[model samples]
Structure formats: C-alpha cells, structure tokens
Target: MSGYAYVTAEGLKKLRAEVEQLERIERPSISRQIGEAIDKGDLSENAEYDAAKEAQGLLEAKISRLRGILANSRIIDETKIDTSKVQMMNKVTIKNQKNGAVMTYTLVSETEADFKQGKLSINTPIAKGLMGKLVGDVVEIQVPNGLIPFEIVDISL
Candidate 1:
C-alpha cells in the first residue's frame, strides 16, 4: 500500500506558488542563459553552455517533481483534526524518558517538514512511532543512534 502524503493547506499553497515561480521566472531565466551561452560560439568547448545546459536539465527535473507532488498532494484539514490522539497535523510535545528533555514538533508530510522550523516528516522514524499514540504513553523510537523512549506529553491542533 502506498503511504499518504499529509500536507497542510499552507504547505500545498506554497508548493503551488513555487510551481508558478518556476514557470514565470526561473524557466525563462534559464532559457535566456542557455540562449546567450549558445550565442558565444563554440558548443564543444563552451563551459558556460555546458553549465547552462546542466542547470536547465536540473531545473526541469525539479519542476517535474514539484508538479508531481502538487498533483498528488492531499491538503490536511487542520480544523477537523481530532485532538484526542496523535495524528497528522498534530503538534505533539514529547519528553525524553531517559534524559527528561522535552521537545515539541508538529508532525507533517515529507514536503511540509522543515527541520529548521521544528516540523518533522510523518514518515520519519520518530513520527511513525508516535502516530496513533495517546498522551502519557511512552513510545520507543529507533533513530540512527538507536532506540530511545519518549513520553507523549500533549497533543493539539
């Protein structure tokens, strides 16, 4: 069975905005760069031409992947979420059972997870272990370091 991609409405909107930006600005800019490089003459030894071509290919691939994600995106309705249990779109606060350190993370889709922003992907080891668990329950999660125990302190929208 294929896993569902749980994304927030704002995250989906951002993806759409990025698609528009690539179509309107980035694609044209790359095309212009390629054209200018081509005008510089020798295609065989032109480093600029080669670089531009590579960039264009990478850009197209990125655009394609983004479009695919947008096509498959399921925007999560945050308002309808049940705050009784840990689920997608839940802001969960967990405390390390061993160390007594607490960290709060918002479980989100892979596309919506920004580690820098404290959002963890639903597919991640920690999030997967926490899913469906209730508050006050300790779940053992396997990280690269090894399995560690974390107690679910709270769950909220």
Candidate 2:
C-alpha cells in the first residue's frame, strides 16, 4: 500500500502505455505549442507562452509520477491466487441484506480500480470489510452514509 502498487499484467501494460503516450505524443505537442508561442514574440506579456510552459510542466510531472508508480508496481500472478476466501483479484458476489440487491465486484489494486467495470479497489470500505471473509459470511461496512450489511454469496478468481 505504501511502497508498492499490486497490479495484474494487463493493468501494468495499460499504465505503461499511458506513460508512453504522454512522453511520445503529449511532450512533443507541448513543445511545439511553446515554440509557436515564442515565435509570436513579446515575452513580457505572452499568455500563450506562459500557458504552454505551465502545461508542459504539468505533463512532465504526470509522466514522472506515473514512472515512479510503475517502478514500485508489483504484478500479481493470477495463477497463484487462492479462491478459498475473499482477497485481492477475487470476484466476489454480495447481496444487500436490506434491499436484497445482488452485485459482483472484482477486488483489485487502487490503480486498477474502475467502478463502471465492476472492479473495486481493495482500499474501499466494502472491500476492506470483505477481506479474508469466506463465502456465506455476513459483513457490515461503514460508508459515508451509514453502515450497510451484506452477505457474501460467492467468491471466485
């Protein structure tokens, strides 16, 4: 959680691709914008130049941050994942005790989480509460609104 970001091979590849796109495409585009602004002259009050420089700085910072994340990332081996209990990378099906609504979510690293895709970050309150819980276990998770009870229906890889 502090020093390393656990991710799947596909997640790692996606992160790497984002970094490449930033460096190869965005960097050059920002440089071109800056050059064009410079050719327009008047350095004392050049809003375009200033904006382009700021954008470049932000892009560089993003690239650096992403590289650091990549450096500290550890890919999780899917083959070794145990499905006996709830844990990272496990697809868990839970039923809302109050409304009887059923939902399935895959527990994944923070970097790989996409709510729309049914991928929940392990850091989330629900995931944290479900961690290490076996199928048929009931858990109560505290969210911003209140505490909600859920029954573990199934857990799989």
Candidate 3:
C-alpha cells in the first residue's frame, strides 16, 4: 500500500546515520568478505563464498528499503503540531474506562515509535482512533479483543 511516512527530526537523523554507516563501513566490510571468498578457490563448494553472497544480498536489500523509506519520509515539526487536537507528535494522556487505568503516550511516526518510551506509532489501532479527538472526548477503539473506551484527559506537544 502507498502511504506517507512521517518522521521526527531525531528519527531522520538516525536514518541518515544508519545510511552513512551502511555506505562507509558495512558496504566495504561486505565487499571484503566477497573478495576473500572469491580468493578461497571453487565457488560451488565454498561455504564462505555462499554465506558472503547471502549476507551481501541481505545488506543490499536493507539499504534499498531504507532508502525508499527515507525518500518518502516527511519530517514532522514537533513544535508546530497542533496540541489543541490529538494529532501526530502530540503527547496524549488517556484513561481506560473499564479499569480506570491511566496511560500516557506520545503519538509519533512509525519510525519513531519506541513502546518502552511510551511513544506509539500513528498507524496503531489506538492512535488511529485517538487522532482528531479532543480532550474530555471518550474514544472507542476496536482491537482484537473488542472495543475499548478511553477518555482523552490531556494533550501536549
């Protein structure tokens, strides 16, 4: 499916760094492996050559995919995002209706999502349901288990 990829400044930086590493370090390392494998003798029986070829293929695939992602990425301005409404880059606090449990999550781009840090991807079910919701609004989200109701308690940058 074709869709826009949103990314934060930090996420963009990380992507650039990764691309640089692949070009500067990983590319050369993999090339060296291939060269050494070629020097080892027969290609049909050389396991090292086969493995190196596989590794090079995987690395090239990764590099291509990442480049595509970067090309389509749109960097989000955290400060300019609308806090008045639930949107990308907004830190939203919600309360579960069933258990009265409160949770805080920053709605971010797919690349920026780090669940351990409470940063959720905008593509997530919960985040999709939460988008455009206002504070004090009760949002009902559909999940595998069923529908979950949550009240938007707060929103910030």
**Best TM-score among the predictions, by candidate number:** 1
1-157: candidate 3 lDDT, tens digit per residue: 2677899888999988898899899989989998999998899999998998899999999898888889998888777888889999999999999889999999988878999999999999999999999999999999887899999999997
Better of 2 and 3 by TM-score: 2
Candidate 2 has a TM-score of 0.93
Q: Candidate 1 residues 2-44, lDDT tens each?
A: 4555678899899899989998999999999999999999899
Task: Choose the strongest candidate by lDDT.
Answer: 2
Quote model 3's TM-score.
Answer: 0.89
In the predicted model 2, the residue pairs found to clash are: none
> Which sequence of candidate numbers ranks them by TM-score, best first?
1, 2, 3
Per-model TM values vs. the true structure: 0.94, 0.93, 0.89
In the range 12-117, model 2's lDDT, one tens digit per residue, is: 9999999999999999999999999999999779999999999999999999988998999999999999989999999999999988999999999988999999
Model 3 has how many clashing residue pairs? 0
Error of 2 at 52 (Å): 1.4
